[model samples]
Target chain A: MAIDERMEGIEAVFLDLDGTIYLGGELIEGASEFLDRLDHRGVKRFFLSNNSSRSVSQYLRKLTRLGIPAREEEVLLSTHDLLNWLEAEGIDDTFLVGTQGMGEMLEARGIRTQSKSPQAVVLGYDTEITYQKLSDASMYLHAGVPLVASHPDLVCPSPVGGLPDVGAYLSLFETTTGVRPVKVCGKPNPSMILGMIGELGLDVECCAMIGDSIYTDMAMADASGVHGILVLSGEATAEDAATSNVRMSLIAPSVDSLCR
Target chain B: MAIDERMEGIEAVFLDLDGTIYLGGELIEGASEFLDRLDHRGVKRFFLSNNSSRSVSQYLRKLTRLGIPAREEEVLLSTHDLLNWLEAEGIDDTFLVGTQGMGEMLEARGIRTQSKSPQAVVLGYDTEITYQKLSDASMYLHAGVPLVASHPDLVCPSPVGGLPDVGAYLSLFETTTGVRPVKVCGKPNPSMILGMIGELGLDVECCAMIGDSIYTDMAMADASGVHGILVLSGEATAEDAATSNVRMSLIAPSVDSLCR
Candidate 1:
């Protein structure tokens, strides 16, 4: 089925960045046009990224630079979900392994990120991670402190093969201390976008999840009772989608074919 | 049975450091006296440690400072076993995650410790580990480079609980890239002390391994055909050895009771 036909009753569509919108620094072909189509059809589109390295301001700048009209409100990140979960769990003190961009975001929300007696260790996509962070985190884990990850991505796709992400770090921590994270926030957790779906008064039947990853995007859609549109312009191929047990409501080469 | 009774026909005894000889900065009670007893009995005593943080010279200095007369030749380390394995496997150029002491040891053996394109990544019990080393190793692993570990001890027993060691680092690497070491060359591998047993022309039956860790010391003894003496001075408790399937020739509170 064509994405236009499948997208008929969908009022809000969640979009994944990186492989879904762009690969590396270059924008995906027709990604901007796809946004324009969503706007023309009076359909709401929200950009969702599991990458915790950048803050909303950084993402807004990147999207603006890419010839895409995106507001701060239209962008959602895994960091936001993590922060929410942290607040919900009443955790104010934490030892964090993340970039300054992510640190600023956490600090702004009243969380002590470098606590000596932290309640938990917050892990993120730390491009500027240090040896000190890994060792400190390992020591804390050895001492029985729980860990929380922003996302579960093993590797972030790059022009090169890929780079180790939170998932990889989580594996390392689990390996070192035989301890796994108590909670992992972000995509496929249902609450990442489902809370917003409820706030917008959108019925589950009128919501759609569009992304490249079946495990994260499609899986979230499945859990949240929303339609899942799998895009194959990223890490996953058509063969992977077909072979996977995940249910993808519609499959398109890219958003380029959507509504055409 | 008393360790002295079990030691009747033993020609040589491999004594594990840390819990067996000493703990942290202090020497274990009766440890030096046990060495004196070995000397009086005309038995050879070799000091063995899986700690990769300290070189043989360092170990000699530590033992000497602790008032135990130990020669450089009397010390055997996991790094030595790892170096032997690397040489046997023809792995020269490699990236290393270890302290300067370990790096110098590898370099002295004509192995490059920071090669970008290398045969393997060497994991050790590095006290001065950094994030750059970890990320670089992860990248190498992502590219399918093999990893080699010095030993499999998860924690270096410290006065305050314990610190993460090569085993922990190995776990981290295994978690990050889903790649375990092609070979871990220490302790239970048996090659650590077995080669020395051969060089000494001592029969395995006449050899004894004395350590507090059953997994490494006792396991190695089992594989190398030596008597395993379980000591309750370090990581293992009386109950741990009691519940374990590992066989022990004798169990002592500490090396304090040895040769009495």
Candidate 2:
């Protein structure tokens, strides 16, 4: 089917950040134009990312600098997904093992970032991870303190190589204390986009998920009952989409090809 | 049988450190007197340990500081066993993930403690563990550098509680990269004492292993065909030994009650 034909009745687009709109500091060519086209089509676009290392404000600053029009409300993150889960569970105090940025984000949302006696241990992609943080959190787990992870990504892409992420840390904690996370909130959970679609009273079919990763972005799109658009601009290639069992509504070189 | 009855044929005694001779910074009650008794009984004593964090010199210092006379030659360590394995396997260069003392122990014995291109990644009980060390060693392992650990101890006993040790670290690396140590050298392997017994030209039945831990000390004795003495001055209790399937020659409140 043609791109426009596949995109026909979609009222909203949930877009991934890294590799989708921008790769590192440079924006993907025609990404801003694609966002402009979404506006012209009266389509609501939400910037979604699994990077819990950065708060919404930091993401907003980066998006603005990259020339992508976005607001705080227009951003969806694994952190927000975590906050929603914690809120539902009636937890306000936690021992967080994450970056300073992540701690600030949780504290700003009224969750105590550091509690002497915590109800749970909140984990994220802590780029600034330390041994003490690991030991402290492991001890907590040994003492039966619950663990909640923002994402299950094993490694983050670095210029040098893949660096250990929360998934690796989770493995460490489980190994040390014989305990695994009680809940992991992030992409592939589908709640991040599905909750938003529900709030907007939009049918899931009226929305489409666009990103480079088949495991996360397309997987979430599939579970949320939304249109899945696999793009080759990021980690995945056209060959990957062709070989994968993941159902895709469209396979484009980038968002540049969509809403054209 | 009486205490001396159990001690009848033993010409040498191997002892565990952390729980047998001392706990934390203080020597166990009657421990020094027990050493004196062993000397009077004409029984040779060797201080054995799975604690690779402390070099033999450090252990000597701690023992001397505690007023228990010990010679450098009388100390046996899991590090020695690891070094023995590395020597036999012809691996001289390694990326060491351990404390400064452990590094010195390996480096002084002709092993390169830090190599850009290492033959293996040697792990120990790294009390001063860092994220950089974990990441660097993990990357090396990911690049196919085999891992060798000093011991398989899950936790090191402390005044407060058990602390995560090399066993936990092994699990972490395994979960992170699907890599396990090619060999774990320490107690219960029997090599730590069996090698010494062979060198000394002594029969295994003429030796006795005494310690507070049933797993390492008693298990080593069972594997090496030596008499097993379970002491209650450390981690294990008489009741634990009673219920445990580990065969023991004797169970005493402390080492002081032995060899009398």
Candidate 3:
């Protein structure tokens, strides 16, 4: 609630990677120090990203390269939520439109990602998309196969700018077959950090969700009853936060300014 | 615009082929007879389509095979409008994400369809879409190249069902690049039929646009000052027409019932 008391009871910080801590390969100024402060203060920090294009390992590698040092457990991707949903639905067969790394993750879980006769069509942030994949996915969807997407993000932030993400593809599918995704797994859905918070034995009230996106990060925090700290290092500007329906618990220039 | 005066003062008919004359390979019931009536009555008929996947020659051949006896001049494709727009804008180089037929049409018009460096991104209903084409288009759009689509039909009606069309691809591009088409050369835009009417020296009020889709066919008629005749053999239904904003001049189960 209060600005100064925002992080008063917080024990864990669910930090958004792209906009909160860094943009592209470069870390924001003071982000390293902010993370160091979290470490020193005994606050558990986990990277949360709605971007499903990159796998957990890739995120870890990127974080390490950027000197943000992260472990596999400290990285949370939308793919994990997708896997959880797939397992829960008892859907072992799927026609996945995702990257090779994502395929590997699904295959590791005994889920066949390229079944000829799939029960569902699982769409992710498929950057390496082909006409064949799109056509096949459309064919299946037209045949009444339910659709599940990794996330609802219309665009993924890149150095070049926002690229069409799974959300855009979903719109394409909707236009083509008049079918929409039955479920979308990612931030703003609450379950994203909620599951992690429960497993880590952290109080929901004491868990702060820090990110630049007000819709996803702040919305998730507000929905899940977690402290939402809006960062201005990325997409959401102060003007955006002022007009947004999803109210942020605290606002910081960037994670670099937090715990300073 | 009364039901009995539907075709009373009509001197020409701008008919939509896919839904009005035929569905996929099979001709609609009484379609040939309806065309015969139009010919017998000396009403000039031109087949209109928003589908740019096929060239004029391809459409003529298909119509011939389907026993529609269509000549080259009788077919008015969205591709024609696309060429008109491109030529008017003095564009000679383009990156086209379309079928071979559409590419051939563009190339014949002295427009380079596949230049490494393009002035514009011309999108069509590409059934033979590839990952490379999409990626290249995305790259160009990201570089701030304007996008021009052939048409905005979400799905192409097929024997199997609805297939992904230009509208679907447009959504993908919009999602990926946040750039919408600067120009869409198809129905609902009065210019689509207005130009043809001007060329043919036909009175716009004396011409009728007959098709199934209310959004495209009827809306085009309403916008272009042509009598709008709706056929229920394809997309629009009686219930749809009843609730739609576009005022229909006449409603029939098929074109067969219109002149009868």
Number of the predicted model whose DockQ against the real structure is largest: 3
At residue A109, candidate 3 shows an lDDT of 92
Report the lDDT of model 1 for residue A100.
88
Per-prediction DockQ, in order?
A: 0.29, 0.32, 0.42
**Candidate 1 residues A35-63, lDDT tens each?**
88889999999999999999999999998
TM-score of chain B of each: 0.95, 0.96, 0.96
TM-score of 2: 0.87
User: Per-residue alpha-carbon lDDT of model 3 for A1-260, expressed as tens digits?
Assistant: 45453366678999998887888778888899888988988989999887777888888888889887788899888888888989999999999999888898899899999999998999998877876788888889989999999989987776666667888888899888889989999888888888989998877877898999988889999999988899889999999999998967888888766775
Off by over 4 Å in 1: A1-11, A36-43, A64-69, A127-135, A138-144, A158-162, B1-11, B36-43, B64-69, B126-132, B158-163
Where does candidate 1 clash, by residue pair? A131-B130, A131-B131
Query: Once model 1 is optimally superposed onto the true structure by TM-score, how far is the C-alpha of residue B258 displaced, in angstroms?
Result: 1.9
Q: Which candidate, 1 or 3, has the higher DockQ?
A: 3
List ranges where model 2 is wrong by over 4 Å. Answer: A1-6, A22-36, A39-42, A57-71, A157-162, A198-201, A233-247, B1-6, B159-161, B235-247
With a 3 Å backbone cut-off (N, CA, C), the pairs that clash in candidate 3 are A164-B176
Model 1 / residue A217 / CA error / Å? 0.7
Q: If scored against the real structure, what TM-score would every candidate get?
A: 0.88, 0.87, 0.77
Write model 3 residue lDDT over B149-218, tens digit each, in one string. 9988888777656778899999888877879999998887787778878988987778888999999999
Per-residue lDDT tens digits of candidate 2, residues A1-260? 22353377889999998889998898988888888888999999999988898988899999888777578899999999999999999999999988888899889889997887889999998877665776777777777889999987777655434567788777767767778899999998988888889889998878999999998899888888899888888888878887888777888888887786
